[model samples]
Target: MGESGTGEARPPSQMIDERIRELGDWRGDVLSQIRALIRQADPAVIEEWKWRGVPVWSRGGIICTGETYKSIVKMTFARGAALQDPSGLFNASLDGNTRRAIDIHEGEAIHPEALKALIRAAVDLNMSRTRR
Candidate 1:
């Protein structure tokens, strides 16, 4: 378990405490914005630890995740390559073989509308996959 700056403790494996501790002011602001986008998109989507340091959102299968690196905050979708990205918000170069990402550079504002659309698309896609 890890202790937050305020001394509240949480499970070590969850790593929410560690992540909060590691995020300095600016990064925390970025993370909060991303988190708000996800929540607004799907109020029912649950948050969980996935792929070690990433924050994952899902209803059935994985939906999306947010990670903070040295230069940017990366929000990745699990089946992003399969999602229709009409807005071209996701960047292919930053994606893994099965996932795609939107990289928000430092000091840049997150596109909340675009993010909500992506999250809704991802949830619909996952629901379709489960039905088949």
Candidate 2:
């Protein structure tokens, strides 16, 4: 499941594990939690390492990316602007024309069901475009 953007054949999952372990703090915890949720949401989701260190998930098409900052763990959906967010989980990158993101802080709590719905929606969106 590990696909390298730099032509490296290393498993992306291993790289992600190293990144998470490197964080070794709350941000790591948050990232790990969200990663688990994403995997749970789509069992077939592929884990990839992009831009050298970013954790990306894709299926049919790009679904989302996991990026961590000092104060937040950002999950940016590839087609977020096209998905419905009735739960209002998207609190960051709200002004983009075609993308959306959820910025989670150290103590922030994520709505698992809502996030699962979002992941499913992203997958559906990707699949829809691929079918065309």
Candidate 3:
């Protein structure tokens, strides 16, 4: 179960929906867009609410996490360091050994196709690993 800010326990999918509603701002819009792209890229992707309030997207393993903060919405990829980001969508956590993140601020425009490509690549990476 995922806990809301109010400390109420609920299903992760339901909690994620409420979190999007609760944001009620540009962050919500960005997160929503990201979610849509992820779903478009991989229809089989699973959404899980983890680390208390974060929105996590996974396939064979974690693909990325959506973390909304005061100034930005961060999408952190679990094996981002190993992925080839030709579009350079990842702008945060670049120095990390295992993860990479894309930080979107207010009014920032996301490249739909580029993000979808990234999401697909992440899913492929997870699937390949699981097959081993």
Candidate 4:
């Protein structure tokens, strides 16, 4: 839980909603779309706010984090290096051994099916790790 502007403790989901509304621009729209896509991909995914208000989606473990900057919306996939991204959605953080990311700028379009496949793969990888 994080404190709101009024200093009240709030759940992560509520905090996420506020963060989206607070953006009030293309970044907000992008974040909102990403959130919906993540939910559609994994209905059991959990929403979390971490490291000072970043939105994280997880199932067995973290699927991705939705982070916003002034010029781009970044979705950093945890354990992304382990997932097979056949559609080539990962354009950022490719240098890392254990993580990958997709950076979306204004007017950029995300391939929904491809992103969903990537997310499902992440979930599968997480579950496999959990069972091990």
Provide the overall lDDT of each model, using Cα atoms, as 2-decimal numbers: 0.77, 0.91, 0.93, 0.93
lDDT of 4 by residue, 1-132 (tens): 487579888888898999999999999999999999989988999999999989999988888999999999999999999888889999999999999999999999989999989998999999898998
Q: Which ten residues in a row have the lowest lDDT in candidate 2?
A: 1-10
Candidate 4 backbone collisions, by pair: none
Q: Sort by TM-score, best first: what order?
A: 4, 3, 2, 1
lDDT of 1 by residue, 1-132 (tens): 345578985543357445756786677688777777788998988877756567778867989777888888787788888888888898744446678988888787777898899999999999898899
Once fitted onto the true fold, the runs of candidate 2 whose alpha carbons sit more than 4 angstroms away are: 1-8
In model 3, which runs have C-alpha deviations exceeding 4 angstroms? 1-9
Error of 4 at 51 (Å): 0.3
**Candidates 2 and 4 compared by TM-score, better number:** 4
Reference-based TM-score of each model: 0.80, 0.92, 0.93, 0.94
Q: lDDT tens digits, residues 1-132, model 3?
A: 455579977776787788899999999999999999999999999989887689999999999999999999999999999999999999999998999999999999999999999999999999999999
lDDT, model 2, position 116: 91
RMSD of each: 3.8, 3.2, 2.6, 1.7
Model 4 stretches astray by more than 4 angstroms? 4-8
Give candidate 4's error at residue 106 in angstroms.
0.1
